[model samples]
Each structure stands twice: as C-alpha cells, then as structure tokens.
Target: MATITSAGAGSGIDLESVISASVAAKKTQLQQPITTKKTNTQITLTGVGQLKSAISTFNTTLAKLSTAGAFNKRAINITQDSDDPILKISSNTDASNGQYNVTVNKLATTSKVEGTFASSTSSLITEDGTLTITAGDGNEFTVDVKKGDTLQQIRKRINNASDNFGLTANIVNTSDGKAKLVIDSGVTGAGNDLKISGSTTELKMFEADTSSATPVTGSSMSRTQQSTNAEIDVDGNILTSDTNTFKDKVQGLDITVLRVSDKDSDGNLKSNKVDITTDKSAIKTLVQEFVSAYNTLIDKSTELGKRNTIVGGESQDDGGALAGDSMPRSIRTLMANTVMEPNSEMTGINSIFQLGIKMDNDGKLSVDTDKFDDALDDNYEQVVALFSGENGVAGKLQTSLKEYTKTGGLISQRQDQLNSDLRDLSSREATAADQLEKYEANLRAQYGSLDTLLAQMQSSASYLSLLSTS
Candidate 1:
C-alpha cells in the first residue's frame, strides 16, 4: 500500500506511520549486529594493547637486574678503637671482609722557612737580581727584585707567579720592630722541601735553605718545619706515603691520614680498627622487587581474563574486555614456563625455588624472607646467578617474552585481526544502511499508487449510485 503523505487518500489508512515503522525495523535488523560486533572488537583490541603494555613494564624489572654489575653494590663500615680522627676511609667492591689495625705514625709535613727584614715596609732588596725558588720535586720559579721593592711587594710577586709550584709567602710583623717573610711549600712529602737561593749578595738575606734535616750554614732564613713522608703501621707492616692519601693500599681501601695517633704508656702507637663487611640487604631488596613485578604481571593478566560477574543479584552478562582470549592465556603460559625452565647452573642456587621465591597455581609469586636471607648469607653470588645469570629466571623471561611482544608477534597478530573485524563491520553497517534506505523508498512508492487506486474506485461507486436513483 502507498503511504498517504497528502490528506486525499481514500484508503483511510495512516500509511506514513506504517512506512516509518517498516524502515525502523529494517534498520534494526540490518545494522544492529554489525554495531555490536564493532563495539566488542574494539574492546578486545584495547584489552590486547593493555596486556602488551603490562608485559613491557614487567620487562623493565628484568632488564635492571640482568647484569653482574648490579650485584656489585658495596656496604662498607669502619669501626675504630681510638677517636684520633686520623683516617677517612672508603672501599669498593674489590675490598675483602676483614679487620685491620692501622696506626698512623706521622702525617706528612710541608717545608717552611722565614727571613727577617729591618721593618714591615722596608725596601728589602736595594738592587735588582733574580731570586730562584725551587722544590725538591723539581718545580721552580724565578722572581726579579727591583732596586727598592718593599718586602710586602716581593711577597705579592712570589705568590702571584704562575710557576710558583706549591709555595706560599706571607709577611708577619714581629713585635721586635722587624718584619718576617715566611715562605712555605704547598706540597707535602719527604723530598719535596723548598730551597730559595739568590743570584746576587743583596737578595741573599731573603734566601731559605730547607733542603737538609738542618738548614745549611750562611742561609739567612730560619727553618720552621721539615717535609716528611706520612708513615702508618698496618697490622705491624710499615707503609709510607708521599702525601697523606693512600689509594688501594689495602686492596680497595683508600685512606687519607689526618694526624698521628697518640702513644700509649709504653710509647706504642694507638690503633684504629678498620672493619669491612658485605652488605646483604641490597641483594634481599632486589629479590623482593622481582617477586613484586612477577606478581603484578600475573595479577593484571588474571584480571583481564575474568568471566561474567553478578552485580546486586543481577548477572552482568559480559565479562572483562579480554575474556576468553586464547592469545593472552598462551602468553601467560609462556611466561610461567620461562620462569621455571632450564634451571640455573650456578653453585648452591640451582633454581629460583632455592632463593625462597615460589610460584602458585595462579602464577603469582611470593617470597620467604627467612629463607631468602639465609640464601643471601650463605651464597650471595649464587643468588645473583639465579635471578640474573645466563639461564636464570629473568634471562629466560627476556628471551621468551619477546615472542609475544615483538613487532608481528602473537599479540600484534591478534590485535591486527580484531582491527580488521572492526573495519569489516563498518563496511557491513554502511551496506545495511543503504539497503534499508532503498527498502523504505520502495514501500513509499508502492503505497502511493494503492491510495490513488482506492480513491478512484470510491468515485466510480458514487457515480453508479446516482444513476440508479434517477
């Protein structure tokens, strides 16, 4: 029947409502299923991407503890018997756990000397000449004294010279109406003493001779301190250093001597006990981190695969986004297998089980702290091997996880298929819409002709009735 858009249809039927209802039914029949399919496909695709991202995050934990260097963290503790403040110590991984008694005998001293002049502002040098300052270490600098340069002026010249090695000059005005020009070597060591000599008689009074144990005769300056090597007795073995700092003197220990230890009643040097021990806490923390990361992967994956649930006594029909997906299940299985396969070859730690990390039926991990501590205490290296070695848990997971996570892997392929389904559904929805449009058009066209036919039949009957009456 035709739909009567105008009010003149004799059929007396509201065909416009009929045509609209028919079109609505066709659209529902043709397009609803495709729309549902697209929605489900998008959910599945999103679920797969989440799974891949979770796996990638877990891989970071694997990468962190995958090296021997990560196991090289050191914990050094020093305990001293005396509070002499003699040594500041540090050690690296190469240091062994042992006790050493170090008695600092003498700290290295710098050579210093002083030359007295007439007054604080006197022209110490009356004529020009060269004053050569040399260190026993072969560093030297020469200064030219003008005819009337004050003692303070000469001090500035000596200090300002770039090649002055490690020498420092200061002028101290004494209470006896005379000025003292004090020059000291900045370097410390037995043979690095300072020697100041002049080329002319006028500058000779400013000369310093600290080269020998006693200042040489005719040297106008008085020796204040002598350069000496730093001496230490480590467990009855004497060790001497040019400077105060001794690096690797006892394997990985670096020591800087600050002062000589005080002697006891019998003139015996006091000793400071150096304590070195392994830090077992770092390894334990690392193991705990591994447990947490593995459990996270398990927990997230399990959540993704959850089935339908009942909410407020009403059954929520659909499950999680990744429900019933075989690829995620297979991915979980692959990881579970890698976490246990091909046991480690390291001594004592044959597997992760020995290190107190265990997996449950749900693929979640938990640690036994007492057992873990015992393992770390007994065999630290083996514990490192079980987690980070060539055939270890992390190692195997790293190799197996790539099969699903890499470009064109199982996860990628599944996502690709889901996306293709979505694209296909879009095309199907468009086709269904086009078909519904044509069906509505056909109904409207056919129903309009029926209305016209019905109106003509009514008119013929009315004309027939009038003729009979006449």
Candidate 2:
C-alpha cells in the first residue's frame, strides 16, 4: 500500500483495489482464529478467578467452625453478694462446667519499711561504706556510701540505682525538720522479702532486713508492712498463692483476690458463687454463619456456570463464560455432597441437618436457628463432634476445596495453561502481521513491473503498425 508509481497508470488497470481486497481476505484467514481464542481465554480466566475468590471467602468462614474452642467455650457468672467484689474471676474454654463458692480470707502483701532521720539533710555516712539489699529471685543490689553523705542523698542514690530491685525509697520530712526514709518493696510473697544491711554500725542503724529475726532495730528504722502469701477458701479447701491472683484454683479458672470478703455478724466470711457453663449461644451463632457462607458459595458457582435461557423460540439470555466448564460444577458437587452426606461415625446427631442446617432443592443451605439452639441445649457435644473432628463437616469441606484453590492448584494450573496459550497466540499474530506487510509490498512491486511492460509493448505495437503503413 506504499505510494509507488500508481500500479495501474501505464496498464489502465485498477490493481491497487485488487491488492487491498486480497490482503484483507488473507488477514481474515490468518488472524481471525487467534483473535477469537484470545477473547475466549480472557473470559474464562475472569470467570475462574471470581469463582476461586468466592471459595476462599467461604473457606475463611469455615475456619471458626472447625475449631473445638468455638463449641467448648465457657461463660461464667458470679453472684455479687457484697458491695466490694472479693475476687475478680475468669475462665477459659478448658474450664469444666461447675459451680464454685469462693471466699478470699487474706490477701498477699509486699514489704514496706521506713527509717527515721533526725534531719532531712544531716550527714549520715562518716566513712566509706556499702549498703547491700538482697531478696529472692536473685534481687541483690548495692549502693556505695561515701563520707559526708546525707540521709536524703542516700535515699536519692537508692532510688536512682540502675540495678535497684523492685523497691522505692522516699524521704518523708516531718513537721519538725525531722525526716523518715520510707522503702516499699514491690517483690511480692513472704519468702521473697527485701533485706537491707550496712557495713558500718552508724549506717546499720538504718538497716532493715525481713529475712533476719530483728527486721528493724534502733530508733531509725521500722517495719510498716510484712510480705505474705494470698490465702483463699474455696468449698472447704484452702489455697495459697504468692500473688494476689490465685490461678487455676477452680480448675481452669483464674481468681485474683481483690480484697478480703466482708464478715457476717457471726464472723463467717461471706462467699460468692461462680457458675461456669458451655457458651451454646455463641457456638450456635457460628454454625449459622457457616451455613450462610456455604449458601453464598453455592449461589456464586451456579451463577458463574449458568446456561443460556430460551424464551419462546429465541435465546433471550447469553450463557456465562464458564457455561460448559467442569471446574465450577465439580466444586459445587463436592461441597454439596459433603453437606448432604450424614456422618457415619457420630451417634444421634450424625449430620449438619440435625444441627438445623437445611438444604434447599436447588442445593443451597438455610439455618433454622431455633432448631439448632434446641439441639445445642439437648445434644451440644454431638453437634460439636459433627463439625470439629478430623472427619467433621468443616474439616472435610476445607480438604476438598484445597485441591482447587491452593497454590498451583487445579484451577490455577488451568489458568496458567490458558495464559501460556494467549502468549503463543500473541507471538504468532505478530509474525503473521510482519509477513503480510512484506507480501503486500511484494504484490505491489510485481504488478508495477507488469504495468511498465504492458506500456512498453503498446508503444512497440504502435511503431510497428506505422512502419507497415509506410
């Protein structure tokens, strides 16, 4: 089609239109098939991706149902008898169903000791000495006192020590310019008491050691609080804890003693009753959600693989891209079979339907919430067993769906093959286009040469006829 000396000018023939029509016919013959294949490939890929996404979302919904915690969860209720709750309580899924009467007799304490000083800033350290403090859990820290160190300065040094164990030191200055060094231990329990000792006698006057017989001596130091364990009475059984929280006292229940229970007129410690039971409502809600998700997946698969509808004598609806594909059909059949099949191993409630998961005629799921709740009230364990074990409904569905949706899965591999075909078609189309360009150019060149030959022959015939006439 490039402008050459007009191909039919000398020969008086319209060769340009002929060449154009021939090239058009050749292009249709060579490239139309590739164009059709590429369009179909793109359509199928889009449909498959949408279907995979739907299956993945449904799988996520099944995750909660496959776990034992979803069914075995425990909710607790405690009687608030006193204005101040004696204990703060909670239970996990592992907690047994039972009732517990709990009473907090005595709570744990941390050691608090204070030392008196005649003046807030009086020089206490006459010579170089070391003040050492020790406790359980490898808590041993020392503060080196230099000469002419005041009581307030020593208190600041203890507070600022980087390696100082769990304790705080404060100088509480009295009204008459006298001061007191108060040290409160954060290390809890009786055996884990804080002990302080100084190398010199004058510094020893400020000593306070809970591990020793005389924890505080002289007029300088006094013990305000002693370290003790938390004690509680539960159903005639006494329990002790190093901290305020008494963990596992009621078999998977953590009871943190807030304060001692109020005493009655007869001096009997008031008690609160705790009830632990299976959380049926939460589990039932999870089952209902799973059914909803299951129905959604079925609906999506049907829409994706739907066939054309014929109204009267004409096709009124165009078929889906995946209308003839077995991938979507197989997925729907697998999930539907898994749902409809009754459990052979489980007794009484052998299937999801017994748990009120009803299937429609068109293969969709519906939840009867009341029936499911009633089943939970009567046969909760059987319902849990139907959905949680290795052969459970959710478990089997996940296993089956994994084949189609996992990395390099069946559908993914199919998509990969289709993309490979599309690339091949693209390469072929480019090569064919290049060859056709050359072909068209060659045809124009040959026809232009023929036109010049015909023009030369006409000139020769005209001269020959003139010679004959002469």
Candidates' lDDT values, in order? Answer: 0.79, 0.82
Q: Tens digit of lDDT per residue, candidate 2, span 1-470?
A: 45464678887889888888888988888888878888888888899999989999988877766865556767778887556667777776568789888888889988878876788777877798888877667888898888999987898888888898767889888888788889887877879877788888777776886665455665367778778899988888999998999888677788998888878899988888888888877776777778788889988898889888888989866877787788878988999899778888976779888877788788888888888889888997788888875678988898889888999999899889988988998998898899888778887898888888988999899999999999
Model 1 lDDT at residue 237:
92
Go through the candidates in order and give the C-alpha RMSD of each one to the true structure. Answer: 9.2, 5.6
What does the lDDT read for residue 162 in candidate 1?
A: 76
Give the lowest summed-lDDT range of ten residues in model 2.
211-220
Model 2, residue 75: C-alpha shift (Å): 2.7
Give per-residue CA lDDT, model 1, range 1-470, as digits (tens): 44445433567767777778888898889888888888888988998899999888888888777754455555755454445467888766566678889899989888999877787586767778888988785789998778888988888889998788868999888898888889888878888878888888777677776766565456668789888889898999999888998888888788889878867899988888877776678767787788898889887888788778889988787676898777667777887877776463555457778778788888888888999889888887777677775466786787788777889987889888888888888889889988997898788777777777777888898899999999
Clash pairs, model 1 backbone: 1-447, 2-447, 2-448, 166-186
